[model samples]
Target: MHVGVDVGGTKVLAVELTGAGADVAVARSAQVPMPGRTAADAEVEAAVARAVADVADGRPLAGVGVSAAGLVDREGRRVRFAAHLPWRDAPVRDRLAERIGVPVVLDNDANCAARAELDAGALRGVDFALLITVGTGIGGAVVVDGHVVRGANGMAGEFGHVQVVPDGLPCECGLRGCWEQYCSGRALERVTRVALGSHLDGPEVAALARAGDPVALEAFATVGTWLGVGAAGLVSALDPERVVIGGGVSAVGDLLLEPARRALGGALQGTSHRDLPTLVPTRFGPEAGAVGAALLAAAGD
Candidate 1:
């Protein structure tokens, strides 16, 4: 058996795998709340260890894979930085491996999500695509020639940090007007708060939208529009055949995607002359990261 851990901004999700390759299946899963933004590195690590042990349930493990939301080094041994997590130039993989008494591999959370899609989800059998995960923040990955493109420094797809708005909202990364500030789960909460004068997380806001709350509907429209606008720029540059949307925020489906499709149509240049990439949702939903990480561990990569 193997275990995969997805350490996100708000929680630590872990899954145990029962097979290898296309036969791989999630045997068990667990989650734990992550430490607050100001948490120490040891606190965050302990949370991850707890999740892994919970999912493992004392069963022996072959290896472990970690899908981290940050700029993981190419060697998968260190996390160069994480805007939402406590790690900064930290040797996370080795530390976790030591604690779990098993080999551990690490990669960017978005990269792991994309790997899952490419293996058996939306991007399967496709050559050239883009994946954008709208969670607590935005995470992106570029797939070209049937593989993810990890650019120099293995941080090619940090799309959230892209400056979409000039001197816009302040970001946790010590930047202003980042794309994530406008088009992520956090973005949804921020917009909803403005409309209803109430604070709600992504899932709560999504629940309100599903219940036909006008404030929630308006929030989705606003964030969805921004999502499309950012995608338009990426489409123009990469021209992938498809763009896959994953992560917690994508659970709303068309409520978010339809508006993004509309905005992409309007914002993309030469739309009438060029074939615009089709936008679709992930097959694995929010668990893609955990599932993909498990696959990586199964493959011993």
Candidate 2:
């Protein structure tokens, strides 16, 4: 058996795999509360270890794969930096390997999601594909042939940071005009709050927009436009054959994709000629990360 762990800001999901790639077994999840004032790195690591132990039981795990939210290094064993977590240049793989008594592999959460999609979700059977996730932030991954493009510094496909507007909305990455600032779940909330003077979760906001809420509808349109613009930029840069979108906001479906499709057509270079890549919603949805992690672990074995 192989263990896969998708470690998110709010929770940790663990899955067992019986075969390679998409052939995943039943999954078990555990909530990981964000550490408070007194939390330390060891504490966080301990939480992860405990979660892995509970899920693994006594099955002999060939390896453990972690899909983490951060800039994982090229080595696939260390976390270079994580915006939400306390880890910076942490040897996550080694720590987990030592505690679990098995090999551990680490990957960026978005990359893992993309891999999962490619293996068994929307991008399956495609030689080249891109996975763009729109959630609290925008994340992208490119797969060429059958392998993921990790870039030279393991920071490629950061489509969120691409500058869309000059000196526009401020981003958490200490930049202005980032694509994420205008296209993410948080962006939707900000727009709705500013226009409606209220906050709504992603699905509720989309429902309101569908129900003739002008402010909510307009907010989605704006975000969709930015999403398409960013996707177009990614297409220009990577030229993938297909693009798959996933995340909470994507649950809004056509409310968001129609505008994105229009914007992509308008913004793409050579819009008048040449074939355009297909843009579709992810098949695996929220479980892509966990499934991908399981696939990675299985492959390592």
Tell me the number of clashing residue pairs for each predicted model: 0, 0
The residue-level lDDT of candidate 1 at 249 comes to 92
lDDT of 1 by residue, 100-168 (tens): 889998999999988988887889888999999888788999999999888888898889989999989
Q: How high is the CA lDDT of each candidate model? A: 0.89, 0.81
Instruction: List pairs with backbone clashes in candidate 1.
Output: none
Q: Quick one: best lDDT, which candidate?
A: 1
Model 2 per-residue lDDT tens digits across residues 1-301: 6767877766677776444445543556555565632457677777777777777786666888888878998888788987777788989999988988888888998899887887777887888888889998988788999788999988777788888899998888999999999999999999888887878887789889879888888898999998888888888977888888988898878888888999999998787787888889987677778778878877782
| TM-score of structure candidate 2 | 0.92
**RMSD to native for every prediction?**
2.0, 2.2
Which regions of candidate 2 deviate over 4 angstroms? 18-30, 36-38, 210-212
Judged by whole-model lDDT over C-alpha atoms, candidate 2 comes out at 0.81
